[model samples]
Target chain A: MTKPTGPSRRTFLKTTAAATLAAPTIVSPSIFAKGDTPAPSDRVVVGSIGVGDLGRRHHLNNKLLVNPRIQVAAVCDVDRNHRDLAANDVLTKSGKMPGVYKDFRDLCDRKDIDAVFVVTPDHWHALVSIYAMETGKDVYCEKPLTLNIEEGKKMVEVARRYGAVFQTGSQQRSEGPFRQAVELIRNGKIGKVQRVDTYIGNIDAGKWQAPITPPPELDWNFWLGPAPYADYFPNRCHYQFRWFSDYSGGKMTDWGAHHNDITQWALEKDQSGPVKVRCEQAQFAPDGPHDVALEFDIAYTYADGVELHCHSQGKNGIKFTGTDGWVFVSRSQKEFDAHDKALLTWQAGDNDVNLPRTETKHPHHDNFLDCIASRQRPICDVEIGHRSATVCHLGNIAIRLGRELQWDPAKEEFVGDDQANQLVGKPMRAPWHL
Target chain B: MATVTELAGDLCSGDQVKTYQAQQALARLSGEIGASGKEAEKAEAAKALAAVLAGVKPAKDNRGEATVDSIKSVNSANELCRALSLLAGEAEVAVLAECLKNIDLRETARWCLARMTCQGAADALVEAYKTATGTEYRVGLINALGRKQGSNVLETLKLAAADKEPEVALAAVEALANTPDAALDAVISSVESGSSSRRAARVARARVRLGSTLLRAGDDAGAKKVFTAVAGADVDEAPKKAAAAAVGG
Candidate 1:
């Protein structure tokens, strides 16, 4: 299953190019060429909600998207500043002013938009995603995929019912190094890998010490969304929301989402999670300030006999150790191996990745865009998202319980222990439904 | 989610078995009363059967490699490694050697070694030695040996680094790069090895030893690519051209 490297970032680029040539009647490369974007017979329209930290960075930049014919028909976010900025950004790029809304549900009601990007926090991801799918919009969500394992389950169910293409923002799955690392593992480059040492670190408690103040114009309650209202801390809000447990699972889900996702994808365990989560931990200085595990050593054991040890190093990256040799990959320029400068030549997954009739490198957003047009599923699709996030949630559960927990992925609960089983899903704030 | 009856070696057989039996009795009693109870009784019966019959012990002192299955398979392998990883004192070292029998699982072997700290990844070296066999592997073994701490690897590595075969010696010297300043000069000679791959790796290791990574941290080489890769290639709009300024510094 593992092909030799030495190709380009699009390693299977030529094959996909040839595929585009052969599949011309359906959406193909000729249609996706920058100026020649064949319109979807019907234009694929989109709306966006909650343009904060994740939204601005992950959803607004579709101008470079290979599918040039798509429209950003509407944008919504509770924060006026974000809404104004996002609206203008879309206008400048697409040459059309999109309708703006403060209420996300109002934005979702628009029949014009066939899809929407839910770039809100962890808590809002489920609600926005489910409602959009129900309203006939495919969804693209930022990663740490869901607030918890329970929300993810419901979101997957809703997407299936509505037949929406839901993409989780695990874009690293598309990156060359990450893909190479996975391919190498899957092919036994590391040789019958047993334990993978994943270093996804912490929010380091003091990082959330900013003054507690919320801006007047922002709807702080709505921003909190499904999460319980906490004393507002500037560091605990916006992009830094990940450090707070009400919205995020600290680094367990923040960086864990990215790192665990690669493990999940490669191990072929994304649709399920480890049956056991054991957190061997240490408390941080004033650990009570943040909600999730402060500094911990945790081991996650999957049903397929692979054990993932997500260790807290306060840094990011994953090191996979197998029976053969091992490879350490990270985003940092400063590293120990520091000299394995092999370039990545991209390859298309003809059999596995199963690209649709369209030809595009932009699989993440393009999935959302294509789903809007063809009414199909995306690559880092929603169920994949929910399963990956469940891995993250298991880490949180182990940390919260302060002990080892045996999870039944088949039933999605802690085995025979009602106290722990109760923790799988969280209590949503009143008046919000997914 | 296969159940093991408290594998920590802490479960006393008589008490543990009796407690398990008592729970079984309770479930059976509950099942006698209702049909709903019957399903649970069946489940408990199945689980009990799985638990009592689950484990397989390795053939003692043979240390020849064996594949275990899980009605004892991968679960057996996982339990063996995990249980073996948790042991302490004199038994830990021998059990780790047993773990090395599965010579193919190097990464887990390295991690288990790192956790064991039995002279800084000695299990990996031992596995490399045990698996490699003959004179060709002596250099690779010596290289792996240098990955460990202590005086034992030093003399052996030094001797191998001066081997009759230049390529073997080159591998030995490369192993010393992982060692400190004591072996710096020995590793440097390999920068121009008879083998290209070995020479390139030596050069790279030497650069790493000199602390010369290709780019500075936050130098943000290929700024747009780096930024897009770090930021959002899928979603984010604002191009931080500021990222370019952060590069090449």
Candidate 2:
């Protein structure tokens, strides 16, 4: 695969020119017929895979469906009920029902779709997004970007090889408070940062539940996809899948993807990661369906001597402590606090470091669509997402192995640790390849 | 500090705390043995774990006859397999291969084998694949072979790719995508002649992947040839689009 050279100025200007000429305006309902299709050149047609909670409620209803320049062309899910609900929702909103698919491949095969929204489980994220990019489609995949370290590496490689505009749904990067805090830290408001503490919550140990017949509306086999086959249990699917090690890294990847992402950005390590990861403490759920860590305290050491601490028991946010002072930020607060109150009001100067900010209501989604038009990278590009997710995955690997791991961020391998390296990439169940 | 024998007993205690502690202790012991740089010590540790695993009786639940003891036995067996996975090498492959026959231990055993990074590991998987009865089980073994990728399993995978069972065949085709010396000519032929759209798509994907391997190895002309053929093949639009993008870029 060709190494990704980012979009050149020539390609960006060409795309911008085409976008300006064909950009769709917000037309009134009376002007455009109820069921008429928008000109292909004017609209970005989208197909959404995995229309469950986050897919339907957040990406579809709130972002994609409402955006005038984007059209929801289709929705796919292994759950019949979920797909029908999503299809009906699209119909009600757009006066035309989008195509419904039980398999994501069917949706990916559509040449008409300009892009795909991959909102599948973490295990399916890499394969689904890779197939989409291979088929020449931009992607907006939710975080954390991959189930294992190797998957993230492969996703970045594939994205760059295909020159796809990929966006990771670490929406916090586009939020007001996170951007402000990162900018402040980057500009030296927190002079010579020393440590960052991220407080993402813990995952509860799942209780042992006997296997039961799956709901008829769900295609259980398809739902498992690349994950290993297991007996069906209600708790093993939908929103609860995160608690299982096979599908997700529990809270480590769930909320850790968001908070730890801000920490990576604040430290300006978007492309690189810590050199050492140590699990200070960890507790696992009893032998049952769910095997992910229930609680964990992990510490990471960067080459520059900056320390990053992630805990399951603290305020659900990130606090960056530096030589000068400390600044803490969270979406829960919608505002940040600093030891020196004046730092909270500090503004960027002409020569100061300034981070990109999203001003729209649906900032993250808007940034994706804008980049798709300009042929530029999104705010949280694939490589950035992979790096942040690597931090979370490293923490999980440490807890699983119950030892400190020496990591080579450049090679993305554990130094002289064969057992640790084994956990880096899992062998997918048959029929799935990255 | 519990002795190895005491920790092994605790592994089957069916108490979550005790089991967790035992697993951790065993893992540390394995790591220590591995770090000691003594091949003899590593083999001894592997032998001890294998003995413990051999002692675990198979769980029975025919007509719901499974007891708490049976569940504990299986759980202990799996934990032992995980410990063995961390450091077991060619010396332990035979015992792990035996574990593959036990339905309860098959997945963990395969995982252990796949991580061995040894020719013996790949050979064990190939031997298992030859006689694996169920479709899912055969697929599992094939996947392990793919992860353990070598020319040794190329013929086995090529044969399995044409298996009558579509599920098993699909699994082989996907696995072949990862094999460096995979028969791309066969895959390309299947892409052109496969009647099923799904089969064609799978082969097309294999060709695209093989082309990528060639491209990465600096065989630019070979890669473009493969990509061009797939782009023009009567396969799904997804692989076609992928090939076109590769060629155009």
Candidate 3:
């Protein structure tokens, strides 16, 4: 594909329209008509991979399909039912039927598509996104950004090496409350942040179920791509995959991806991470299908001596306490609170540190699209997402080893701990790798 | 703090807390000895762990005759292996290699071999890969070789890349993708042009990786040439697009 010269297509079109008013013969007036569909050349063609629950409902229906700037040209899923449903949803919404495929590689291979949305399970995220980026497509992948520390590092390396536009779906970065909380903390509204507490809840282990033949529409082997081979149990696939260690890190990575991400942003540690992590307490279910930690309390110590605590109990939110006061934020009705009520209404002055703000209805997706056109980094770029996800992975590693780990943030390795380092990158099953 | 002998005994105590504490203490001692530049002490500690490993009997629950003692012995053996992963060197390679053949201890043994920086570890894995009969076991050895990438294992991987079993071939191809060696380029290129869809996907990924490797080495023209070739090839679209993107940028 040829790169657009100078201004982006959208910007050029806007400039052309402004000039057309002054010099009436430059371009056709019909091209600038409001509500007209963007020409094929101007549209950001996208392929949707892993179009399951979040892929179809949240990303496609709620965001990409409705965004006038994007065109969903293809959809892929391991389960035929999901791809077909997604194809129908696209047809119904846009009056155009997208190419549906069972394999993500086919979708990634399409030269016509400029980008892809990766909403697969955590295990599949790195491979799919890396492949998409390798094929020269920008990626908007769901969080947590990777299944392990090494995958995150590889993702960042590939993104930078390819210069691909990457947006990790840590939408909390785009939410008003989260953005406000981060801005307040950064601007010293809470003084110097000494500690942060995040509660992201927990998950119960999955009971062992007898293996059964997979459904005809579902390619169970493909669904378990990269993960270790296991017999097909219904609960092991789809939404329940989160509870299994082979597929995910359970709630530590699931809910931790959100709240901990906010904590990272508030503490201005998006690009870096804590120097040490300790699992204060942890409990796992009896040997069953699911082996992820069911309850845990993890603590992280930054190089600057700031402490961040993550727990499986208490209100589901983040609290930042500084020397002067504290600010609590969550997605609930009590979105923002502070020791001093006046801090909530305080506005940034000319000298205060200010982060990017998104006023669009779908702020995160809008930010991604905007960055795609502008060739600028999104709010949750690959590196930022990787670092935030590292926090979650480190916690899980500590709990699994039942020991505290000293982390070297720069080298992205455990300090003299080979066993802990082994968990950094797992051996992928045959045929799949980063 | 317990002496190395005391910790070694506790490691086999079969008590969960004691075994855990012993594992932690041994790891800490290994780290401290490593820091203090005491190679002899580290080797001696590793020997003690290996000795403990050999003495611990295998759990014989296959016949539904598992006893508390047998279970404890198995747990103790596993815990000793975990410690060896942190402390083992060339001195412990033989014992660890022996453990690689035991079904129960193979994982922990492979875990240790994968992390060992010693040349013996790589040699042991390559030897195991050659004689291993089980497909899954061979795949595991191939993975360890991939992590222990060097000139030593490249030939082994190239041979495995042509294995009759598709799973083994694919794993070898995936492992070879990380290695940007000129020797393996022909093999990967041939696979890219081959009939297998899964193998071809890996080759496409490898080609793109080669292009990136060229770009990183400041061979811009060479990188662009590679990108252009991949883009024009009839391979999977993802790698083609990636090549095109590299050239376009």
Candidate 4:
């Protein structure tokens, strides 16, 4: 199929000019146009995919139910019990029963559903999001954006091709302190930035889960959709799936999705990444159950001479050091810190750049809805998500290969190293073509 | 903060001196080779590349052959394809597939498409092969598609195997040799009918290879069946011996 052309350059230029001059928070009135009358028709109909922990608790019960402007039209999960629970919760809260589906495609096919909240496993992220977009539904996909680097690339391309407004679940982008830290860095409060230190946590290794029959409530095949088929075990399916490379990228991508994202935003390098990546002091379990790194320090160097140091031993946050000063912030941190405490009080002038603002339980989710109405790009768009995820994936590659690799960010490739480039995009099992 | 559009204009300027400078400016805007550019900058470069591909004409070489020699001479052809790959989709794939007809740029274009994350790229190659008039060019496109993995290209390979041109059909058969069960089934059926095996020796070898895939998948029964068939086939001695060894017949 031939790709569709985007809006003309002239149109893009005009829209950009308007966006640049507008306030940091740009919300289209159509999102709440019917809300003035408070009618059901006016409410944005949203479907919640994967009614698991975050899907049920944070997304459906907390945010979607609480948001008056949104109506939870559908809840889908491969696990029958999870979907039923979510549907029941929605009914109890909204006094209306939501349509339940065992398959995500059924949810996407609904004409009433305007958008989908994909809180599925990392491996399913790109497929579900792409399929939803292909069905003409906007998506708020959870991070890390994809299971592998190739999947992320495909997600970005397909999202744009279908004109879908995609928001990655990198909520750090929406947090107040994170934005403030980025703004401070952007305004050069930290002088010419040189290095950034990000600490998320250690990787999980040397743990094995014996194969067990999948629970009756779950459709193991559907759950393992694009991921390689494997014998089911309790630990390999749910929250613990993060420990497996086939399902997730361990803590490197898990927490790195948030911290590396902020690092990219602060460096204003969301479209690109570091040129060279190296790992030191890494160890791994010989056999499976969980096969991620034990511990390591990863170093990434940008062509323009900026450095990013990621390790597990440091404070659990990002510390940006520049010529003059430094600043640090983390989700777990009670308060943000700067070299000079007064720097935290620095406000932007009329001419200073202000990143977009989001203040909701899931700011990125709210941003997705707003962008769906405005036909604008969300704060953490698919491309930005892909780039951020690429950083984490690179760290994993460096560790796994036990070597330093030169990366060409512009080409999104490892420079002249066929072996390294091979890891950039892995082959999927049969019947699953991305 | 030079706009990618401005830099792209410089790149397409035909003047050797100005074009190199323009390429440098575009490279810098993309944040050197090793660095990452801003989102806006990346977007602009993508747009600029699209526009250049659409409008920029090929330059004349010293031998007066109409070629993109100006860009190729400076190693910018690969660079252009890389930039295009960054923002590539079906549209970019179509353009690159068309470039496969250009012998000078075919390798670079294939390399560009091979590295892309877009799945439509494989489909584009198949589409290009069907439409490609020249037997040689069609074979080249088939060879390129051969290196691609996935079942997406399976049907295309099967179709190409039926080509009236023996060369094209042979190339398609050669490509199908490494495919899994599905493609193997098609190859086996074609060989049984004595149509796909114009080069009979390769078909015997492919059968042996398919049988090997089954053996590795732990389907000894199916593997033995395939090997027995190849061993029984009225073909070359080499393939018969190979199949006999596989089945220990």
Candidate 5:
């Protein structure tokens, strides 16, 4: 579905004001208005799929549970402890018990749930999000969107087919500074774009640990889901899973999904990708729990003649260098700046381009809810998410194959490399095929 | 998990779930078996697959709900074909080539034939491409041959590159692009001297993209050469300008 050409601020305010009179449950015109919580009917009913580590800290605790605009209706995770903790946390805050589900499928089947925040391991993203969408639920799937290129394609197809509102969890798209940076670049605040340099953290060269029995709280098989089967190793699950090829694409996709995503948005290349990808240098462990690139310097060439250089050595953010100036933004640094400091402070003239803006402090989930109401594509639409993730996946594939690849962005395939095409759609373990 | 033999037996099972699981397991094991350490072991695995295919026949049983049952059957056949494709030999290729007639199995059968290591694989596909009447099937076969990994397959792709069907020609041209230095030159020649404006446009786009990639990688001279070539071609203005931009015109 196309991105919604949302109403102007004045029209949105007027429409919401009228809507508030007809439905007292509508939140006030000021989203962060302090007076009162919106009526229960006005709240977006959200369920959370994974409640472990980052999911709990960022989405469940900080956003879903605390946000008055959302009512946490259910919590699902393979781990009973994490699910129970999340449900309890919601209960304490809202004084209402959320349904606890062992299987995310059961959570999706709930009629009370309007949307789901899919924070599962990378392998489960497509399955949970697609199923939820098919069941008439909107999805806020965590990035990187899918385990393979095929999965992402299927996800985009199913979401559109079902008319589902989807928002990928590349939350940077919602941040004010990122939007401002992209706007500046899009408006040519930096003269004709030269190159984008992105730095994701170095890969963790982990060795395959001896197999250990899974803890009682974890349903290991369910967690593995569509990925190939492997014996249990604690580090190969949860937050540490990012380093493994089986479950994740290492830090390249982990952080790359975020920074590389912003780079695509700034370049206005979200619908397309680089025509060529080459991994200049990389080191992979001989055998391991992780087989991703330990160090990498990959280069991509877009059809428009712009270069996107990705590496592990540079600052852990994105640098957009244009002929006039360059802007650098890093999440960890909690700062964004430009070569000419004045560029950061530059204001757009009346004719200058301005991207859709969101309310200050409005978390990404709010954007998902807003789109659900508006029936529009979110800031990080499924197609946008897939394209960005494709960039990261291409880099990983190049490094692993130790060759430069000619990519047909229109076809979304390696020009003629049968071997590389084989890696594009990974074979799922039985009963889990897409 | 069932052994390959056990799963192969279950392939003929009446229960749909068992059959599905068996198909998946066999397909997975075939890839492993094809790559097994011992050559004799690999050959035996391929033979076992041939035996399985010889006995298995496509069921024409039309349930009232054709969509659901057919979808299930197509999916199962897809997995079965995948298993056989990974391990097919000369004998297996013949069996898979025969499967190309079955509408539900044709795509997967062609895919299997392409990936088979049998010496006859490419020849079998070229023969099939000649006899195949359906445009989609011919296109599939052309793509399969295009993906083959040798110089021996280039002549067949070159012939298909001149096919009357634009789709067929485009597929062959795409395959030519995949070949290292030699075949790419052939593709450029075909496009440069060819009469099809559409095919020429496609080739020019790829050529300009190559130039753009070269420029991005800091190879100014290489980029300039690619851009210079395409800039003079009968391409749309967009690619010409893109080429000039790559050369800083």
Candidate 6:
């Protein structure tokens, strides 16, 4: 935080880092960024999948319509309520009610839509995207890429085969410090990037079961989707999925996909992978029906000798360790000092307005749209999302198997151990096939 | 390092000679250091940053207005509020408050109304409330003024507390806690309103918080007055809620 305290002001447009990721009332990634936007022309006919809590938030935060270049054409969710909210929002804004669907597949099958936004839980990320791409629709899938490693790889394969521009919703790469940290590390600011200390807030692991009380508004079976069926815990659906093993990788993937992705990016590897992972978890909180690890520290080592340390702390941020002084970045709108500002400037010292630029204008979505329009890879591409997600899945696998496992970052698989290898990809419950 | 007066003068006076000198000193201090852990050096760095402010002109709008025009060019309410807040203290606060009235910068007027303790704030807050009716800024104005003059402003606030509007009534009740000793009992009694009692409770809570400020300032009598009220009352209720905010010994 620049000028941490006081009523007076002087510093040149410095803001705290915490405000960066905060979802303001109804922010669409569109409402913020200044110039990366290209005249808001050539609209992408977009549709949504799994419009529950996240569906509404994504719909609200996406500034695609503000560009006048994008149109939300269809909405789909297991719940009519979820779909209606998004459809209504689009209808109200654009004077066109989107075709609503109770089944995501129905939405994915549509030929008119140019893009599909898969903001469903981790499990549905792969299933919906695979189908969306099969039907010739481009996709913007939400974080943790997929439920497990193999699905992530498959999703990547399908995306590549279909010639679809797949952008993962790991928006951190769209942030300035994250990009700056990577640039500094890639350009050798931290010298030889040897270690990374990543903190993504607290998330405890284990089973959580709430009273099977079903809200009249909820469609529980459809909500559970591909996951192994459990009692209808409303908290487990829509919002609290991050706390469970079935749908989410706790905060490891929730916030980890964000910070960890930056850690790996700063290490100069998006297509490459972290070779080994060891996990140490502490279950400090009682399992109140949520299953993700609450307090844990997982250390990830790259094959080339770089080690990334990820831990759940009270605060959330990413710290990159170059051989020199480390640069710590919080996912906030905090001001950068002259030193931090230098980290954001391009290696060329001008027009580095891409991901991790110095300006505080929220530019994540604009980058995605720019890539979509230009048919270029976005700052956070599908491969980058899979790699970041692999870090989280590997940590989960180590913790779940109660042992460390060697990984092939190149093949995207576990190395010698058959038992741990099996856990890399999970089976999708029938009727919800990917 | 420049003295406080020199820092303030360099900031307000449009003197380039002083500005250039200050910037050079700041750059050297920021650049020459290689992470010295010495407390004195850190203090010196802070002093250098402070000196930079000496010639720190008011951060202008992209349009170069000391303040943006309310009728046009502003994009977000937050931006407007931020500009108003910047005007509150970073530069000339009173002038900004006065400007809001003529320009009809409603959001900025409301923001500045609650924030300012300068002499012009009281009149502005009252006017903003009269025009906007049922807004939070009026209470922010009354309470901000109350924090400055306490009971001296109680009679003026009593009308606001009794107003038919609930939010304004709540603000009046809050201001009541800061009322003069003569009105303290009335402020305490006013906590009976079902809708506005929480405001009274918070007012009582403020007294608890104000205790240390009074004690630190060597106003032990005022500190004791608040502390005694909290210690003797129901923990949840206010006016008597003051003790929790004070140090026991």
The candidate that achieves the highest TM-score relative to the unseen native structure? 2
State the interface C-alpha RMSD of candidate 1: 24.2
DockQ scores for all predicted structures: 0.01, 0.29, 0.17, 0.02, 0.02, 0.01
TM-score sort, best first: 2, 3, 5, 4, 1, 6
What tier of docking accuracy does candidate 6 attain? Answer: incorrect
Candidate 3 backbone collisions, by pair:
A109-B238, A135-B242
lDDT (Cα) of model 4 = 0.72
Model 1: how far residue B14 lies from native, Å: 53
* lDDT, candidate 3, at A82: 96
Show where candidate 2 strays beyond 4 Å: A1-14, A17-41, A285-290, A332-335, B1-49, B52-84, B99-108, B133-136, B158-193, B228-249
Question: Candidate 6: which stretches are off by over 4 Å?
Answer: A1-41, A204-210, A284-288, A333-362, B1-249
Model 2 has an lDDT value of 0.80
User: Which CAPRI category fits model 5?
Assistant: incorrect
**Of models 1 and 3, which has the larger lDDT?**
3
Compose the digit string of candidate 1's lDDT tens values, residues B1-249.
123244322221323233333333322232232133244443443333223322334334334444332112333333233323322223344444444454333323333343333453564455445454345335535544644666656656666666665655655665554454422443444344554433443333332322211122232232323333323222111111212222322
**Candidate 1 docking: what grade?**
incorrect
**Candidate 4: segments with Cα more than 4 A from true spot:** A1-38, A203-207, A286-288, A360-362, B1-249
Candidate 5, residues B1-249, lDDT tens digits: the string is 666656666665544446545654553354344332545665676677666655555546565546555554455555566556555567667777777766656666776676565568887787677767666667778767765666557777777777777767766765665454432544644644257544555566556544544554676676677777766666745456555655566
- Evaluated at residue A219, the lDDT of candidate 4 is 98
Which TM-score does chain B of candidate 3 obtain?
0.83
Which candidate gets the maximum DockQ versus the true structure? 2
Q: By DockQ, highest first, what's the ranking?
A: 2, 3, 5, 4, 1, 6
TM-score of 5: 0.63
Clashing residue pairs for model 5: A207-A289, A208-A289
- Which candidate leads the pack in lDDT? 2
Off by over 4 Å in 3: A1-8, A11-37, A286-289, B1-121, B128-143, B158-249
Residue runs of model 5 more than 4 Å from their true location after superposition = A1-36, A332-335, B1-249
For every model shown, what is its TM-score relative to the native structure?
0.56, 0.84, 0.76, 0.63, 0.63, 0.55
